[model samples]
Target chain A: MSEPNTREITYLEAVREALTQEMRRDPSVFLLGEDIGVYGGAFGVTRGMLEEFGPERVRDTPISEAAIAGAATGAALMGMRPVMEIMFMDFITIAMNQLVNQAAKIRFMFGGKASIPMVIRTPAGSGTGAAAQHCQSLEAWFINVPGIKVVAPATPYDAKGLLIAAIRDNNPVLFMEHKLLYRTKGPVPEELYSIPLGQAVVRREGRDATVLAYSVMVPRALEAAEQLSREGIELEVIDLRSLKPLDQATIVASVSKTGRVLIVHEAPRTGGFGGELAAVIAESEAFDYLDAPIRRLAGRDIPIPYNRTLERAAVPQVEDIVAAARALAQEGR
Target chain B: MTEFVPHPILDPAVIPRGSQQLLRELPKERLAWMLQKMCEIRYFEEKAEELYVRGLVHGTMHLSIGQEASSVGSIAALRPDDLIIHHHRGHGHTIAKGADLKRMMAEFLGKECGYCRGRGGSMHIADIPGGNLGATGVVGSGIPTAVGIALALQMRRSPQVLLAFFGDGAVNLGEFHEALNMAAIWKLPVVFICENNQYGMSGPAKVMCAVQPLSVRAIAYNMPGQTVDGNDVLAVYQVTQAAVERARRGEGPAFIENYTYRWRGHSKSDRNVYRTQAEIDEWKQRCPIARFKQLLIEAHVLTPEEVETIDAQAKMAIERAAEEALVCPEPSPENLEAEVYAP
Candidate 1:
């Protein structure tokens, strides 16, 4: 099958397109999870899949996340690349044993004779006001586990490319899709391409301060960077596409050039992805280029409340990111 | 229909001679092989207990003291290509799946010659090439992995079956129930073997399970379930043979509850504060080893002299394996980070 010519689509469409393309390419590839078929998906990412391939290939499993994950892991080990659609990112906690214990460690425990080439796609981040249970940015949980690759794509280009790459990779990959960015559009190439799992992309170039962000935070950081540009604060923005195998080189390069760094994420400030980025910079040669202690603008440690105002307050808004960037830019080395 | 009595089926004195025809059917050579494997497992675990007490085995040890029949007999029914995922009390399964004794001993010693290259000690040893995927310290975790392997075999059009072994405690876990349900629904070629050794480390199976028989739970998943004499090697072997054949023939997964008892505590450090000594004595009387030896004697397959010779040979083999493992070099500190992930 030839690649689709649509260059611009929603993040959800990009994900659906990736699944469609991969399923067509490999007979062993299948999708299973709640509401992934007939109903399209909880987020409608798998809409029309049932019509295209039917339920055998695009299966709608029970509400048991553990079973869904275990089934995917089993299927993956049996020479199938199962792409599982977790309805909500928070529900991933229910399947941690299979994801963290079984899927991630099987290959290594079996001395590399086996591999779980499975991908778990879930909608993550707060902002939709789905509350604490449904909306969460739990990519950090997966980052700590070995043998599995974790990717949080912020753009349609990345969403499609990385999904394709994950399906093809020889290890388990957790693909966390931002719930807020599913409808957001970006230019994705028509040719079949893949963004490597551990590589980071420079979203913007600047010289004053390096703004590192991931998933939904990338767009917020980009919006803040646009406003900061007018104030003569050239903010360099980095999209950490893959959290597990973090692209430390890109982060260090930008920090080295700008001499200032500010990390931003939707997860809570304490023990969040920002802490990892901060530690990486502090431990790397880029620490010498610091103009001030690295600042982290992140969500407050609390359940994502139901109210819109509280939800917005819990996460780092654009203004909050802008203020943090200004503070890093003005500080002395 | 004959009414089933709730008793350890390995008690040859109670079981009618006709009921034990399966145990006597094995030829002399096969009986000797089964006896050798049971002795290997028993002696290996006995040695492991000694090493653990002396603080030589680094991690916790889940020894298979009195439940050798489940692994030895059940695994004997599987082909070399068939896969098995063992539990923490998995040395029997590993050896039954054909893991090398030298490497198996070295693994407990954390030597470079260990099957996991010293990364995984007793509880986590894995030999994938030999068809033993690995043993999990976490209960019920291997059930899903085995189901997945069976699913893989079905996809590849292979007739190989997957034998997933877990303990009585694991059956209460959601993963166990979920994996079994999925395998049943998909008609996946897998056998769910529950080594019901009376207790899950102080928690007796009777208290955890509402129904007396664990095999009855399989009907809920719409699959064939059976209860076998876990202590009797022949009964365990016959039931497992039927399950494996059913799976290979695309008849779907089967549930098996092997009724047995563990003579050791849950782990090495366990002091028997949970149960009474009288109960242990009661189970020890029905030990599968003694029952098998008696049956072999009555069948004229082995005399007293040969039984002693076999015991001596088993002891010698253990001494040689232990000596080699003790002298084997400990894994280099530089190799500590190895095998964490595939490069």
Candidate 2:
């Protein structure tokens, strides 16, 4: 609830600002993770925070994902809002029990006696050429869980706003930051503000087909829609900022208008979140309005290759989205 | 060591020299309360076992029947405001941390008035308001969470300590080492107590363990570690007392391995193929409740008559709780999705 900064900043800077502002606004909010202190995090998302907040608030911890996640869960139970950076989303595998079983289920298991007010921030996606070990989109794992919330912000504006919202949310939240989206600059208000979770923002409105996306895929969907607009084909692109408390109303309304759907994500297709989105449409009133079968454009079911060329082919690209959107848009015509 | 069997009785020489005199100097009322709580836990699980065998309770449960001293003594050392996190076999931890007996039984019976509103059964019952954060079905899950609570307390500069309870099985988990190492480095105010009942399911810790005592792993973290006769209530209390006080003083975490035994099989589904009935019978002869009763009588903290009266009261209390829990309304399916996330 403060004034926003008028200047433009990168998505990574926006995330740091949110952490800085939240820690400043509330004493209970703190940051902890490996290399977050002096090293400024593995990707520099928390660079200047250590100097400003000191070691106590900006804790540099051992590389223990389980402890990092479990510590956040415990601290949240004690009424402290802790933000833990997992360095890479792929490393979250080591901490899944704490993330899925303990942190996610604590509130419900305790009958609402406690709420785990914690955030797990990890840089995700396949563009970094960091290979299968570091580059992968696993947001679907957190979304599959019942108690935790998942936030995948697309722009600098959403990155800051959703991070603030996630910190204030009285539940475990997994915040996915695409490695490529970090440097993309956009207008962000410097003052304290929050974007409510589960609210979808329609980046582009169209009548031909609806493009559902999140995280890094949102921008690609927007660019794909931009490319097709010249051919009189307009694609509606909806960025699902929050995954668990899904904005089904927005998704349904978009699909109802367009009568076609194209779900895109960086994760492999076999059991990715696209399947859940497709099921949501098929099971809802949106199914009645469908003009064509829903199409899913996702990563192939294989380990991400370290080779730059194969990595690009392993996940969806702007070209991939353009082709997928073009096909879905012209299917019924 | 390959054959799983514990000494039928405890060695009196293993008791710490000044601990009994420390017991004399301690509050008599607290000792009496611990005795009563231990009895209540024993009877509570016995009743729960009876129900599960009768097809009344839902799902399988892990019983800490032979490990009551480890729960009661460690919890007894904490201040009322201090927090705790329990492992799956945690009825004793919940009860010792001052949960409502009737409500606990209601949870076991899957009633709406239960702790988790029947959403969580035996392995997940919690009493958060009363300082028990709850338990998870997974082994060693609570270790890091307990350290996290300690980190919170450290940030707030709170004197409150977190007493984390787990089993011998949990000591082998990756999270255990990670959590302990972090706790030591941060000097977080927490006490990690391992209820080493010797088996993780059918696999005996004696065969699986690389170290003699589970607490020895704490040395890797450069934290204090101790192994105590968990059957001796006073001994558990003594070791936990030092660790709790050390944590309150911000000296960092301590690990205490309570060498106890679980008289029952791991759970209802266990067929007892791993251990013999002779071993079970041996542990039964060294029941924590009976040992505590003898300790109290000799120390004058409680008389033989007083111990029996407490035992009777505890048994009656458990029975009354069971009766009330059995008739409580079943939880409605409506609003089942409400608690999945906080509003």
Give the root-mean-square deviation of each candidate in angstroms.
3.7, 3.5
lDDT of 2 by residue, B1-343 (tens): 5853222112233344555786777788898899899999999999999999899987778899989999998898889998888889999999999999999999988899999988888989988789988887899999988888999999999989999989999988999999999999999999998999999998899888888767667768888788888988878887788888878888888888999999888998889889999999999999988888887888787878999999999999999999999999998888768888887
Model 2 docking tier (incorrect/acceptable/medium/high) = high
Candidate 1 lDDT, B1-343, residue by residue in tens: 6664443222333234442575456677877777888888889989988887787877778888899899998998888788888788999999888788889999888887888767678888888778787888788988877766777787678988889999999999988878888888878899999999989988999999877799878878888788888998887888788789888999899998999999989987789898999999999999888887787777778887787778778777887898899888876666434555444
Could you tell me the lDDT of residue A62 within candidate 1? 71
Query: Candidate 2 chain A: minimum summed lDDT over ten consecutive residues — where?
Result: A1-10
lDDT for each of the candidates?
0.85, 0.90
Model 2 error, position B223 (Å): 0.9
Clash pairs (backbone) in predicted model 2? A4-A190, A4-A191, A5-A189, A5-A190
User: For every model shown, what is its TM-score relative to the native structure?
Assistant: 0.93, 0.96
TM-score attained by model 1: 0.93
Per-residue alpha-carbon lDDT of candidate 2 for residues A227-299, written as tens digits (9 for 90 to 100): 9898888999999988878999999999999999999998999999999999999999999999999999999
- Candidate topping lDDT: 2
Cand. 2 Cα-lDDT: 0.90
